[model samples]
Target: MRNNRAAPPWAHRWALPAMVLVTVFFVAPFLLNVRFAFSSWTSFRAEITWNGLENFGTLIDQDLLANAVTVTVLYAVLCMAIQNTVSLSLALALQRTSRINTIFRSAFFLPTLISPLAAGYIWRGLLAPDGAVNSFLGIEWAWLGEPSTALLVVAFIDAWKWSGLITLVYIAGLNSIPRSLLESATVDGAGPWTRFRRVVFPMLAPALTFNVAVTLVGALSAYDVIAATTGGGPGDHTRALNVVMRQQWGQGFFGSASALGFTVTLLVIATAVPLVWWLRRREVAG
Candidate 1:
């Protein structure tokens, strides 16, 4: 014979605070943003009147939306590529456990703990025309003032800031692989590169999926680093979608800013959904 009893009320109440916080903070703001995106809310106006699609139309006419989209995609792509490359290299190099590797991992991860804005400001100072970087190289160049190089430089810095975390993820993935698999490959006379390409790489599909998706989304939503470093300057060469939204907000175009934010949300969803699906498929295939 068995007896059944429902859980205590307190047992289910544990999640209530988290649910309330999520509704109040994330869900509420998102709904409000959607509503504002369809209205005419601005600092110059006392009333927020419905103006369906007007804000988006105006942005489209001005070509600001296209430019922001292009810049944002470019920046995201560059960051994803650079961060993953650096991270994978570091993970491979430090996969072996040792005191030196531990020290190096800690040192690399220290940058991840710093505020993005603060890191940008630090990089700003270092990349100035007469800054330490130029002095050390014995040459002067305005790193942040050049249109062609500013975006890439900012992307590299963003990658530098996050590579540590991604490296740790890769290291975790590497350690999870069966040691016998690597040893078998070695006995089969497979070289390091061949082993990685044929065995280790395929086994790391899940980690690659997580790292790539995260890095792409983070880069798409990047603002603080670009703001502190270039402020979307050098003629808007590095102006991400968020930077453009901030500019719109500053210019008393609240509805337009909200529309831009909504667009960013849409872009992220659209991009990430397909990418994650494709990555998951690749994981299965691997």
Candidate 2:
């Protein structure tokens, strides 16, 4: 008997509150941000008059937009590369389900649980001119003070913070591969490196896609660690787009700030869409 009865009203009642919350919080704020991006709202004035693309023009003229975009892209790329490399290595090292491996995994993952700001602050002290790092290395180098290395240092910190989570994802993907395939490859006289390169690595495409997309996007929008570490210091060398938006907002350039936010959103969508599409194709091919 195929009883095609509609779902009861209470069965779906909870969704209403969730939808309302999304509308009130995410959707509404996003729409308002778009509205303000094209306006002339500032601390100097109350009336928000539409000025077309003037806010964007102002930002472009100031070179703030270009600088922020460049810094953000470089930071994101560095973080993505570092994080994936570290995470993949960790995943491989901890692939076996042994007591030692378990303990080490837990130890490594503890950092992921810590607040980013706290991590940044801790690293800031450690990387200070006369801090633990310098003490250990016996070289009193200013890690966060140098324009050349400050951005890289901050990017490394961000990558370190999130590598554990990405490692677990890779571990999960590795574990999902059937043992039969590995055993078959072993019997066929395939070496460890060859088997991994030809079999294991290709099989991890889905995980790779997820980890790469997430790390890249998250780095693009990074703020907390950088804020606590450098505050976009060394003469705005490490200033991400979000930090630039915050500076504008602090100075009461609401419209310009909103324009920056909108630009970030567009950039994320632009980068992520194509990246994901290409990654998905690789997954299929793999």
Candidate 3:
């Protein structure tokens, strides 16, 4: 008879190290920061006092807070929709075997390899008043200024830079579909759209879930690009929740920033949980 170990003994060895690292790096700092959110920092020693929910109440009463929430939601929805749609379309277009497909796929993914911050900086130069975009169009438009275009410009940039990454993910999902199922659908006289709707789409739900969730998170957390481009606006027109939180930090309102941080974290988890539940429910139902 062969003797089997009860679970892997090595798991116990790694558990302690993992817990220690997480505590040292993540959990401890997060708790400390949350404490800061409730306390004030002065010139003397780092003093932390219990301030109840004053920070949160103050944030809620600010106009900037309202604008930040609205803009953040708009950006998240638009960017996720556009990025996912365009990316999946491109992935579908490139799924075939051809020299053009290979070349196109490489071109599509190239933008994603560059850091988001770097891309924002590069775009800052190109979208300036006399930059190439407006120059080519023969009109001087404020890509980063003016309330009308500031948020739109940032949203567009977010979509352009990140769409390709989601495209690759979709491509992986597409490729994993069994060719036999597709062929069988074809033989049954199902049209291309029909096959995609009834068969291909369902199989890609997991990938779609992943892509959309990440895109939403990225959009909500957009700071570097907006900061690099318009510095949060012609006049805070494009300010997101993250931007507001950072401004609080800059003002040495650590307690307020920490409160905002916790708020944002909760908001993210709140949105993600419902989305994941719905997607999983549908996946199961179908």
Candidate 4:
């Protein structure tokens, strides 16, 4: 008689534990969150009756919804734009081999290694009216205090912290380009701009997709920087969805907060779905 193929021993031992943890921590909590989204909640009790789409209606009908969606979308777009532009520029500048390049790259990445809260606080001081930024420029604008400048400052802080990460991603993509392709292009009288536009960029699509996706999600979920810098202050001018959710939770609106969270997740998926599909098609075509 032939022996039956044995299951992997590691699967029998580790897989069950992994599944248990995932179910307990991730799947269970997510289900509970969905349940909360469909209920009415107070500080100590869930209404327990099915509210169906009422929670969603409240979330949508609020004026904060308009502000949240607009600001979040704008933040995502601006973050992607600034991060990609600065990162690609840095990647190009650092493609050369030199001690200076190594030092600059390390320095640039230092901010990313710091906690977002810490980085935000650091910049908060720097952007104060009497601080380094204004002192250096001789402009006495209060960065985080003014409604006009608060959101801009928050966006700038995020870009400063994360552009290094995108730069590294772009650098890896840049290195993956076939040297032979670059040399061949040079031989064919292709200028640096042509080589980048035609050969390098198309190849960097995968990296671009990743960088943009991360930037979008990160910017949309932005709270740490704003919390640390302005605490979503100046009359909520810099308040993000995450901050709003926190405020609701504090006000004993757990169900409402959960509903807002679910909505944000949906927004993320809505933004990512088309980009992911388009990138996959591009990969197939390439």
Candidate 5:
């Protein structure tokens, strides 16, 4: 009953080292942070005290958490929707290889190369009253100065910066489809829209899964952009969960911030699991 196949030599050689590295770098620190999440601090980051549900209780009492959750959900949803749609559309438009397509592809992808901090600052200036956007439009609406528009503005900026990467992912997916299948569809009297609907869209599920997951993670992890642009204002209207965590950390609420971070991690995992599963099912079904 004990028939055994020998493992590869490389696996035996490297597995222990890899496990050791992971435990040292990731597992150890993660356990330490989990400990921090349940522990309390006194004075200005002075002394540590173990507290049972006190931090969670504090988070519940802080009404900002509710606002942060709402804003973060809205922000993540908008980013996911707008970025995925625009990117997929653009990828479809530029699927074929050509000089024009190449040029546009580079241009579209340029924004993703910029640091988020720089992008935030760039958008901040553009949204200012006397900035280029207002100057070009001949209107003086303060984009980041009002709670009504600030969250939307930040969400849009986040989408604009990241959609290029999503587009490229979609393009890769599009490129993977065989020309023969598309030609056959055309020969069989399939219109452009019909072919895309029946063939292109379904096959792009992998890209959709990847893009959705990445953008969801990116949108949730948004911090430097908010820090540089709004600093969780127009009166905390644009404050995402990560921004709230950072602010909490700054105010020396380490346990509360850790709890918020853990919540965010759980939320991302929950959303991503369902999304990836749904898209993958579509792939198989299609």
Candidate 6:
């Protein structure tokens, strides 16, 4: 005797609800931006008028957009580098579970829970001319008010805030390695460096890919932290693409801002697609 009930249909999976939510909240708004990118608006007081490609044309007439590209790319790259290095090192150090390790893990990850605005303000205070950092170092210069150091300091601050997240990601990857594999390597008389290089690093490829992708995207879109700390100063030295978009908005260039944002979205997509594809290939090869 056999059961007669048919299996459930898989045409409409449970992901449909999430897809619908994204369509409503994200995709719709993105399409709206595309539509508005070709139109002009000064403020809420004025009607949006179609201006063809004039908004994009204005982007080419000025050096602001070019400078923004350089600043944004540099800042984002620094953030990705600092965060990944700190997080991976922390993960390797914290791999062994112990009472002390648990306490330290909690302490390190505490920054992630702090609001970006609050973290930015706190660092701003610490980096002030007369603040704790300068007081401790016996310097009179303003770290966040100088063109030479402001952008790097801002990137470092962003890295500090998010490193804990990638630490956790790396920890999960580290913990997933089988003890048997490590034991086999030990039996082969492999030293720690050799064992890690040959076995552990290869296995952690997925975590690396994930950390890189998320951090790159986050750094490119950084806003609130920069807003609270440097506000795109000193003299636009720390302005990322998003901060530049905000400046355009503040100056009542809504249509041009939309075009700028659209350009940024295309840039991120262009960057992420290739990088992610390469990482996925590396995962397979590893």
TM-score against truth, every candidate: 0.93, 0.94, 0.90, 0.91, 0.91, 0.90
**What tens digits encode model 6's per-residue C-alpha lDDT throughout 96-197?**
899998888999999898888888999999999999998888988888999999988899899999888889999999999888998999999999998999
Tens-digit per-residue lDDT, 131-199, candidate 3: 999899999987788788888778878888988889989998999889999999999999999999998
* Model 1 weakest lDDT span, ten residues long: 1-10
- lDDT of model 1 at residue 203? 97
Question: What is candidate 4's lDDT per residue for 51-81, written digit by digit as tens?
Answer: 7877767867776666777777776777778
How well does model 4 score by local distance difference test? 0.84
**Which candidate ranks first by lDDT, i.e. highest?**
1
Off by over 4 Å in 5: 1-5, 16-18, 42-50
Local accuracy of candidate 5 as per-residue lDDT tens digits, 86-188:
8998998888889999999999999999888888999999999899999999999889988888888888888888888888899999999888999999999
Number of residue pairs clashing in candidate 4, backbone atoms closer than 3 angstroms, sequence gap of 3 or more or interchain: 0
Span of 10 residues, lowest total lDDT, candidate 2 = 2-11
Q: What would the per-residue lDDT of candidate 1 be over residues 1-286, giving only the tens digit for each residue?
A: 6544877778669989999999999999999999999999989995998999999999999888988888998999999999999999999999988999999999999989988898899999999999999999999999989998899989988998899999999999999999999999999999999999999999999999999999999899989899899999888899889999999999999999999999889889988999999999988998
Clashes (N, CA, C under 3 Å) per candidate = 0, 0, 1, 0, 0, 0
Task: Show where candidate 2 strays beyond 4 Å.
Answer: 1-12
TM-score-best of 2 and 5: 2
Error of 3 at 279 (Å): 0.9
**Poorest 10 consecutive residues of model 3 by lDDT?**
37-46
Q: Which pairs clash in model 1? A: none
lDDT comparison, 2 vs 6, better candidate: 2
Candidate 6: TM-score? 0.90
For each candidate, C-alpha RMSD in Å?
Answer: 2.4, 1.9, 2.5, 2.9, 2.5, 3.1
